[model samples]
Target: IGIFMWVSSTEASWQDFRKPCIAVVDAKTPTTRIIRAVSVVLLPFLVGFLGYNSMKPSTDEPIELRTVHPAPPASTKVHGKTFVLQTASNPYRVDDSGKYSDKVQNDYKDGNPWDEKAPQFLQYVREGGQIFFQNCHFCHGDNLNGRGMFAFAFNPIPANFTDAGTIAQLQETFVFWRVSKGGIGLPREGFPWASVMPPWEQHLTIDEIWKVILFEYWHTGYYPRTWD
Candidate 1:
């Protein structure tokens, strides 16, 4: 009697477990048979449709990417003098009217700190390099390439001293005026000056400014303009 009871309970549990699976496809019931048949036919078609859609290429147009070129520098005249753009479109005119213009021009023409192999000239270049790294490197970069740490903060970006469009075409007097007066010295009649370059007259000695200029030309292998 005990064995018979245990076998009866086991059969009942098996029937309970199989009840759901049997109901899923009860062939005698028309509704269950229809659902099972529809699922068997439609599942493969649905999967195939999805797979086909996934494999198909997109019909959208390709995107075009054009290079963004910087605008050319504008030309302007200041106080009966013509000033052209140099180094990131900054307008600079030679200091032909200043007291020390001739002196600065003369020193530039001498060209010792760059072309000379003499010990004193080399020493001058060395001193200029020291000054540049100390004061100017933060904005102009160690390579004088103008891509300094703070360069991205400015719109037009810092002057690329290595570019031929910059120091290559400029006169030494131009350099002198820009360095001594900084942004405030820019003529009001010219393009709106918005640079943060401070007046170095209060900060750097005149001699130190000159030395840095020499170092710039020497380091970059660029020569100052011989003409106006």
Candidate 2:
């Protein structure tokens, strides 16, 4: 009777110990629940900040923004040559001014006349140089030496303006005429050779043409002696 009683008591004790263990397993609680929740909330924002920093544009720390001023007007007094001052917006009309006409007879067959003013001549040179760079630099080159970027592909290469002998031989009127009319066989001439010269009469005024001419003349060392 004593042995039966001891066995029943032992079995009851074991049952009592197992009950708490089973309850614990059923609860299924994580140890770091609070930490995990905080991490999940902040992770997206942290990742986005890092990505934005990587993609940010670089700064130009040392350089400052600058404002450019418009260039002053150019003037010249080459006796037979007329210099007109007009903007690109108000181009001269061929009908209103005899400067540009389709009539071959109106072409500047005579060369430019010599002027005697130094100050006016210098101003013309400065203005002409700027115009040449803006319009003719792509094909005529910055030095007016004719080896422009596109000169190689051209069948008849652009004329070298720096060649003193050549400049001496060429008349000012011829230069103006060529610039006004452009090449004949190339694309400019509406032919197969592909001259790239655009007709400036539509875009540039007669005064602008004169300015360019003055610049070319001064570039070749022909400074004017008078201003009037």
Cα lDDT, all candidates: 0.64, 0.51
| lDDT (Cα, tens digit) per residue for candidate 1, span 1-228 | 775566457778667766755876676688778777777778888999999999999997555432122232244333334445342221111233323232343344445544445345555667788888889888889899988898888756678899888877776546756776676666655535556677776678767877788778777877676543
Worst 10-residue lDDT window, candidate 1: 87-96
What is candidate 2's CA lDDT for residue 214?
A: 61
Q: How many steric overlaps are in each model, in order?
A: 0, 9
Per-residue lDDT value at 212 in model 2 = 80
TM-score of each: 0.49, 0.40
Model 1 regions lying over 4 Å from their true place:
1-118
lDDT of 1 at 59: 96
Over 126-150, each residue of candidate 2 has an lDDT whose tens digit, in order, gives 6667788888877778788888898
